[model samples]
Target chain A: MSGIRLVGVLGGMGPAATVDFYGKLVEETAATCDQGHVPVVIWGDPRVPDRSLSLLGGGEDPTPYLRRGVEALKQAGCEVLAVPCNTAHAFVPRLAEEAGLELVSIIEVTAEALAADGVRAAGVLATSGTLHAGLYANALRRYGVAAIEPDEPGQRRVMAAIGAVKSGGVRPAHRRALEEVARSLADRGAERIVTACTELVLAMDGSHVPVPVLDPARLLARRVAGMALGAALTG
Target chain B: MSGIRLVGVLGGMGPAATVDFYGKLVEETAATCDQGHVPVVIWGDPRVPDRSLSLLGGGEDPTPYLRRGVEALKQAGCEVLAVPCNTAHAFVPRLAEEAGLELVSIIEVTAEALAADGVRAAGVLATSGTLHAGLYANALRRYGVAAIEPDEPGQRRVMAAIGAVKSGGVRPAHRRALEEVARSLADRGAERIVTACTELVLAMDGSHVPVPVLDPARLLARRVAGMALGAALTG
Candidate 1:
């Protein structure tokens, strides 16, 4: 039997999202037996300073903690790396460079998926850090797709929903807030909605959205699974 | 805020079970925010040689692979360890000793839980390897709780259901088979049913069973979360 690549997940920007990504990865892989699935090593350090808080210049810089996670994954012999949090991807390039590992960019993959689907415009739902950093915007721009973002009030709703998910289970209020923001984005001519925040993916279901939903975390999981199983070429 | 301990999960005996365990851990934590949850590092090497096959002397030894996982977790700075698979507990004693980390035994925790509940006899649903190893029987015996196992035919059904879950998603057939066995065990005077196998925990829901179900994985997750969050003492 051919060997599968060991994929490392640098996670716990919030613990639930990391678990969500891992679960999706297992579901996406074409494995008949236990050994047929991809081997994974995850460093889920929830203590890593909040990515959004840091990006907004209000909290401690998460670089050192993120670097520690990358080093641990590299030491454990992971050939490829995936960071589940969209905001955390802002630091992924530097971490991948320092660790000399093939890091899968969730933003790039989502953009590529949108372009492949002939989507001209997509609404992004993510943390303030991810929106401020333009991680998804820049990637989507490169694919010739227009990235629509939430208005200030909508963004607040998005952040509130995200906070609700992170703090505990998603209540009906959180889901309703996200659905409203998604509907507003759709009314503004968004062809599809991208759940850029991992926590948002947990809160908002695709069926409840006004338009088709694109989950970056699930896309990342599928890409990582494909790479590990050798079903798709590792880029 | 006080620091939470990093718990290492040596998993992927079947990838889905590990995901289930981690998800439960996240849910069980008294976290209102991401950092309030336990930090975790998982070495999910699905490639580990089959624990059941090894115990039955029909396949390669899983010791070296398990040792590799233990060493990887130790190097990652995990202060405590948990293995999600019930069959894997057969090697937990040696691995804990070799790694010098506190390894939480799912079997022992389950027994403790049963004893605390004043359960006199409990039905166990697990893999043949775990049955052969007498992990639950011995642990439960220590707590003065009688462990009732499936008869030979029922055991075969249990193994088949586990294999079904590992191969892919659990089907209605698999759940039906397990429910039947659980019913038979209940009819035989089992006070409670212990879903000793992690995979069985995934396939069979507690409400569907004839008696109250105790999931060792959930218990393990709760125990580890408590220990990590300083809610309970680490044994």
Candidate 2:
């Protein structure tokens, strides 16, 4: 049904995260020339009701907005869709079914990646919405990878770091707070740490972490590129 | 028509340049929160026939592909448009007329910026396609800003630097070559240097240019952001 599948990005869960995902997609593609890069149709509707706020019962439903974005991308010729925000994956299955487009789940993809890498247990750093909805927890469990989350206070720190990044305060304090949480998770026997939140990926610079950090956004970019290019995926 | 205008990005003249433009748009927006950022519908079709080759009499016309992108962005509700590629602007006035979208001209924006900044003469660094079509030259002259282009050998180096960037070969040597060209232009009494080519923007780090570098893309981004936010335009 395709020559090259167009990658639809359901973005603007946060504007910066969407831009970061697009940049990573360009960087991960094995293109010798510009034409070799994947074709992307980004529906960056910043109006999408905030996912975390909804999951926390503090905001409106994001389903309708997400559905509209999916429809727009499909109309624009995207054969496969990916939402860069991890919290947004809660609506993926339903939206993917409704849109009839192959949706790439950041949670499922990351869990599969962890299982494939023989990780028995992994630490997750994400928004309270993601943890509350069991987005990563359920996926990891289904993939036979135990999900370890930071303690309540640690989770608060993660949320604060995420908030700082979204507010354009990607300072060293934000990174340090995340690193401290990652270290605490590693102390509790997490073999690897998953930066499940896109904002957290922006905050933490992948340095000085106690364990190896797994960035699902980067993985999703590689997967999207491989699928678009019809190449064996490896990252 | 009553609300803030949606920004349509006619992109993928080269994938990296599109990303750079989007990033700049996000950065330049006067946003204190995620919702404050502009809504962008990007039609990043990498398969658009090469603009430079088409302009230089070596490739198919890019008009059809550009029209499709503009149409898609319009259908997705982009009220205003901007194309990041300077070479792509050769088709802008016509496409903007046909598509009935208010397209922001990077060349015009830069020339206006130069004139506003009280600069009488400026040097241009861009692809042969842009130079040959006099995109910046004509726009600068219209604004009473004298446009100075690289001499034959210097032009060759600039073209090579652009090719290096397009092929994803952004080596230090490429940056050095472009810097040498900029320095030579400065030596010839050019007061301000206009980085008319997006690729050249990628190569030169903007740290050590002898004179001020007027980045048209950055100017375009700021303009697009200001327009979308309904703010007074200033660079």
Candidate 3:
């Protein structure tokens, strides 16, 4: 089958990223106006511990919240699950196991998208946890997509945007500052960018970069849709 | 009441706008990531007879499509209706009448936003149909906001980009060409701007202009959410 009917989003790593992923799936899908695009079921549980906080021991383990979110989407008739949180991917396997739905891995799809685009050199713009854990770097290297990240200062800009959004201070200016970091990645010859964090898409509010920006959320959505519909999906 | 939620969108017409609205709703709402954003139903029916096509003739009545779209959202459990198309607003009263939910009027909010900003003279960058329809101009004028659109050539550039997106193209150069109109409007002494057409927003892509850009789609979404959730919305 060519068309997958529905995709589920297991979100709330943060509110902003959840929205970014849902929007991208609709934007990228090839669908007629009257014909339905794949219907999406999203679970945006912002109450979950910040994915990083749980990992860092600053908050309670998010496994319970994650399971709840995954179950909510499954109950909504979602055939496949896509987590919009870069940091939460660490917990995805367990969450999927608990929920018993095929959850597409954001990090894995991101790495795959980069390789497909011939991104020999790419940037991983995510949180301190994703970076410190070497999650994307590990996945990308397997696909020959050389991964890059900002310097400490560049990382700060990203962190600032993430902090701003979480604190509800999501001003356009804060987003602009992050775009500057993205510009640097491109300037440094990074072939593609993985918006590894949910908040990072805010930086592109009215912009798209010259090279392909590998949106992990969207890729995961398509894959989830494929799995749910039992549609043939080319890796 | 303070924490009552509202839908927020970053729309740009061209099917993408409606999709963006639905996607953002699912992304940012109080739900699970997999559960999708709140219960948003989108009528991403971009093939509605373009206002330009209709105004210039040889097109079908957008009224039928608009009716169908608004009803679709309502049928899908939308508590509030929002038409992401700027020009199609000419038929909004009809669409609203057909909808099961309250329709958020973008023109009124844009004017209100201008008035609150203390803007008496505001620049406008929209498709030719919207500019010619004078919906924003009339609405703003009531609030004592003198709405000024780009010069004739500027209007042409804006329309070209609108055409591009409606035709399913997302070219950056085409968007830049449209941005020049906003810049020109800013240079012409307009204190604020209304991105009059939903398509005009696709061209904006979060780039900074000299002043505020009143994104009607986002505003409409906010209003829709507010009304849906019974929240008191300001601006």
Candidate 4:
């Protein structure tokens, strides 16, 4: 494992997010040779107890199962663990503590990256669970950056796209609605549209959008790669 | 971990192959709910040093890296590790030994499924390295089943499609050439077309061939599900 930090990803909130993170890791890493590819240990168990169910008191507490997943990764030789699912981040602190691995914080990195790029206020087009959790709001506050989200109707559309993507169906109507949500956010002063969900990143097919997209999964992938390459992890 | 067996997949020979395996896993697993979904860990480091370069003697040996990958999975809490790459199976024994996890054999599963289906003979379509290494030949010997393959020209066509897929260019020509190889193999007493490469499985699109088409990855996925579900692992 010399010069290689195995990234343990506790994923499968939906398959698309895991695929997006893996793609970004492959694309961002500067590989002189094939050997430079970052080593990622991905447990894309979408079977993970539903985040909303447990959070909303409609389902079993996800702690036992989530902890089991984290333990699975720690045993698998992952030095750092990442959860690509925006909703699943709610349980991050406990999961990290129980698993005993340094987690690559998704919310903090997104806020910092946007602020660094001089985007003081960026649009966060994410699912209702993510919006309600205030994960980004808490993180962005420190940096004096505002986290923008969709209006109620727009939120429903974003949730619809997310549901379609989670179910492994990418319908045309879904794409149009999602793009409308992005445009609406931009119209409401969003400097950039954050494709917070992994599926959104994959669903984005170079549609002509005025606002730049900040895919949080892709950003986290960069941090994970930097750790893998011994690049000081400064960012 | 008690009832489920985590399947470890060392993939990323090309991005498409890994995607194919993932889709097959989703399709084959018997999941009433998400948790019933098989617990899988995939290490899709596409930059793992090229196999041909190491095998044909240019770069360092891939065997060491392959071993490391298996170890990564073993540490990832995988009960059984499987290599989705057909050619990589050529180095399985050594890697499996180093990883100390039960390595599910792809060639064995493909052959067993064919023999069980009463396939006295079949067409084997795979990568150049898989063919050159006799991975299929040895596996088919057990059932006394004769398998036809492409002639030199047909081999060239098959190799071309495999190369095109690995490079992320999905062209009509590549699909056309693969179809031609399937036809050629059928002309030579092939009762079934064995999709040895996962990419070939998608290219074939589950459209029944003049001869029946067998998907080895799908079959392998079924076997993993069986092993995990405590159902009999048949072919």
Better of 3 and 4 by lDDT: 4
Better of 1 and 3 by TM-score: 1
Position A94, candidate 1: lDDT: 91
Please tell me which model should have the higher TM-score, number 2 or number 4. 2
Q: Which rank order by TM-score, best down to worst?
A: 1, 2, 4, 3
Question: Top DockQ: which candidate number?
Answer: 1
Which sections of candidate 3 miss by over 4 Å?
Answer: A1-12, A19-81, A87-103, A110-165, A168-235, B1-3, B6-12, B15-84, B91-102, B116-124, B128-134, B141-156, B165-193, B202-235
| All candidates: TM-score | 0.97, 0.96, 0.56, 0.78
Per-residue lDDT over B40-71 for candidate 2, one digit per residue giving the tens place of the 0 to 100 score: 89988888888888999999999998989998
Error of 2 at B223 (Å): 0.8
Which pairs clash in the backbone of model 2?
none
Model 4 TM-score is 0.78
Candidate 4 lDDT, A7-125, residue by residue in tens: 78887666556656676776667554335566667877766777766765677777776787788778877878888877788887778877789988888788889889888787887
Which consecutive 10 residues in model 1 chain A have the weakest lDDT in total? A226-235
| Native contacts matched by each model | 0.93, 0.69, 0.04, 0.41
lDDT of 3 by residue, B34-131 (tens): 22223333333334565655654556767675665555444434455566667767677566665545657788877887788789898887766677
Residue B131 alpha-carbon offset, candidate 4, angstroms: 2.1
Q: Which stretches of candidate 1 lie over 4 Å from their true place?
A: A1-3, A231-235, B1-3, B231-235
Query: Which residue window of length 10 is worst by lDDT in model 2 chain A?
Result: A226-235
Q: Scored by Cα lDDT, where does model 1 land?
A: 0.91
Model 1: per-residue lDDT, tens digit, B139-205? 9999999999999999999999899889886789889989999999999989999999999888886
Task: Please give the lDDT score at residue B159 for candidate 1.
Answer: 92
